[model samples]
Target chain A: MSGKLFRNFSFLSATLSFFLLVGIFAILFTYAQDAMHAFGIDFLFNETWEADEDDEGGVFGGFIPIVGTLLSTIIAMVIATPLAMGIAIFLTEIASPKISKGVSVAIELLAAIPSIIYGMWGLFYFAPIVQKTVGGDGVGLLTAGIVLAIMIIPFMASITRDSMNTTPLVLKESAYAMGATKFEVIKDVIMPYAKGGIIGSIILALGRALGETMAVAFLIGSVMSLPHRITDPTTSIPVLLANNFAEAQDLEMSAMYYLALVLFVVSFVIISAAKFYFFGKKAK
Target chain B: MNRLFVNKLILGLSTLSAVIGIGFLFWILITLSYKGITSIHWSTFTNDLVEGGIRNLLVGQFTMAILASFLAVPLGMMAGIYLREYGHGSKLASVIRNLSDVMMSAPSIVIGVFVFALLVDPFGGYNGWAGIVALAIMMIPIIISTTDNMLALVPKELREAGIALGGSKHKIILQIVIKAAKVGITTGILLSFARIIGETAPLLFTSANNQFFTMDLNGQFPSLTVSIYNLATYPDEASRELAWAASFILTMIVLCINLIGRFVIRNKK
Candidate 1:
């Protein structure tokens, strides 16, 4: 191909993400119109998900799944953020070079394991332990959230470590020369310097936890009923779609579309905020 | 003395946290291997799902993943080439870069939903093509980011030498710049391939699940991950064992590919 033609082709390929984003939004919005009109604003609050006797149409709402998604993600973030910070600190501040490198690889390998495996492992071994120690059935919000926390810890720690590693050695030495305690120096120097990236990594992990499907699917119990407690069974939007979207018909199907749209839009906003607002300036 | 105590306490807690992190990794791996190995049989590799073997699921998963790579690699590499070479420092390049980053983290299931609406809803039903498209969508952003970052690592001095040699822009990029970044790009490709192949959510609805071995793209296809999801939930010992076996194999494939990718880059260095 001619150079100009080749360049144009490349440009077209480069624009694919933008078009795909818009296309997904447009298609979901268009498909979701039936639900939008049928339930209107009440769809967010309506609790009962039921079909008419004919199996043709149904009254569907997103509140249970929406709340489930939010609560599970909140639980995950609360659990993950501190642990991830500690791991980052351990890797950057405490470990010797040789030990640090080996641990880093182990953490990355942990991250590489598929989400489905987490789900299976959670269902079998982890859930039983949770059942014995905690109060509820093996699968619930608490179980799902903790396993999800483990899943995202590696990602958050790696990114946080990268940013912490960027702190200048001279700055650290200056703090130490001033007789600052190790904790004090880290809290005063590295924390302030890498605050943006640290927060960015946390938010990014939050976003991942928000939309995670397989792991949460197995652990969340996939019940439509709202959870009465942290250990109670409930379903999230992705789980709801994964299990029910195919069998749904007419208005119920449209409601599923509406849920997917909400998920896509919320994640788009969250990930974009983390990228542009937090990491935008120093990302390169 | 109080300051020293606080430092020691915080340091101890951080060390405990790393231990907890590593502890979970070994816990899962050990459990997976013990269960997987105990359940494996000679027939496990020879039979299809209809006869209770994983041969078809493996083939099906590989077929879709490889086809996705075929679609994504060329398009993603071209996009990366545009970002680093032709559109360097341009307004449009920056915009695409940011969008691709956002796309990278957008939930995989939403991509499945989008593909279902476009390919499955209109085309009548679940098919291999829809599954491939959903996976391709997931793979493209990953490939784009990798290719972009890898190409950016090529030195400016090298490009200047190509220009001094009177090579065309495309020729220089194809022959010199891309060659310089080949190892990094290959590793990226391999890593992305591992990511997409392990995905269960996107294929959950797109390919649904087939009980029999079939190569037809117009019909439902077997998926190892999706089948594991279905089988694990079944209230039977046999199916549960199969699920464990499948999960072990899938994890091994993913982790091995990742190790190989790291090894390749380390060897180059």
Candidate 2:
């Protein structure tokens, strides 16, 4: 009887705690619903943000920020994915165990540095270099993307390495037994097997880049327009939310909240997709 | 000969890429030190901003971070404990676990917005208390996830031994389970501090940046992060330089926390 009571108590506590966790999502959804009613369907696709105007009211077109987020993340993925794959391949298929362990640890450390530090560094150092080389005023999509590439590289490399390492050794051995070359084994055997995980890692990195605020805000010029070129000044959604929240005008405030909700929904979808892809049936 | 050369070439390229990543980090640290260390005067550490330094902001940041962690760590640990030790395979537990994962991945700015709506807008003003609330919200999920992970790592035999010794479930958890997971819990707390210390976005809306210093929890207090943001954007050259210096200092503090937390966890094993 006492054992059953303890079990019941534990079960009840767990149930309550889980509900508390779900409550956070419920709160976000509630706010999102309110924002939708206030803004309507135009919230998702509109590109013009006129927070100061009346009658036409504050038109909150989110296209520029949306495009900026997607473009920068895509650029980051393009730059990071190959570099991460190379690092993973080198570690798993080439390097000695001692060097591989040390290299992997160093990469993991990069993941721990705060995003704001990356922002400060990008603003102070990287932007100038980018400006000098790329010939821009200072901040733009290219610089933000490059910085994000550096930031997300560790995540991509670590996960890819883990997935590659987990690929059955027997497959690699069999490939070698067939007189296949080293590069051929990795290309034909390892890469194909870890393909799902590699894609999942890229998606996860995309989610991170999309939601990144401080780093992007500092480096990406806070312009509310779409970029015509990688060097053109642009604003991302998180930066928009951060900048507007500080201004605290009524429309600006609501618009910021609406944009934040959009970012949240987009990131939520990407993260859920990544979880499904990486964890497979176990995710359910 | 060609195959051997190609293999060496691939290895060299991989080594070069790894070096580039590490080189960037070193370069950042070197530049931060050069820019910031020059301005490292006694006033920056000793006097209050009203008295011409950031003593108050420094102290305020410390207080706010500590207070937020205090609130967040316990609740998160409790939730984690409830989830890992007692709530196996139940629908409610699964829901909570998934919710915590979502919260973990939710954008920090979104969290800032949520806190502002729930706290600042309702109160019609921003305060340090609101900042603490926002930071605590961010800290909670991290703590819950880490604590739950650590608790799950505790060997079942230890728990069974305590149980066989006629220990109450509460006592077993408190003594055996928690004691084993202490280092991980501490590491979680330290990571939470690292996360909140440099956080500027959520605080942007909720904390309302203060230029001068104030210690009152109900009043606006300048934090190192907001200070960096404000100083960075100022038109003055002095402010921009100072922003770099301040950012350098903030980064060092965060690095110290992370390294120390890692050291502690490593030592425990």
For this target, which candidate reaches the highest lDDT against the unseen true structure? Answer: 1
Give Cα distance to truth, residue A190, candidate 2, Å: 3.3
Model 2 agreement with the true structure over B2-81: per-residue lDDT tens digits:
87677667667776777887787788788888988986677778866555466777787888889998878877887788
Q: Which residues of candidate 2, in runs, are more than 4 Å off?
A: A1-39, A52-56, A168-171, A281-284, B1-10, B50-52
Candidate that would win on DockQ: 1
Which ten residues in a row are the worst by lDDT in model 1 chain A? A275-284
Which candidate achieves the best TM-score against the true structure? 1
Off by over 4 Å in 1: A282-284
Q: Per-residue lDDT tens digits of candidate 1, residues A13-81? A: 999999999999999999999999999978988888898989888898899999999999999999989
- Per candidate, chain B TM-score? 0.99, 0.94
The residue-by-residue lDDT of candidate 2 on A121-210, one tens digit each, is 898789999999988877999999999999999988888888889889999999999987787787789889988888888888888888
Docking class of 1: high
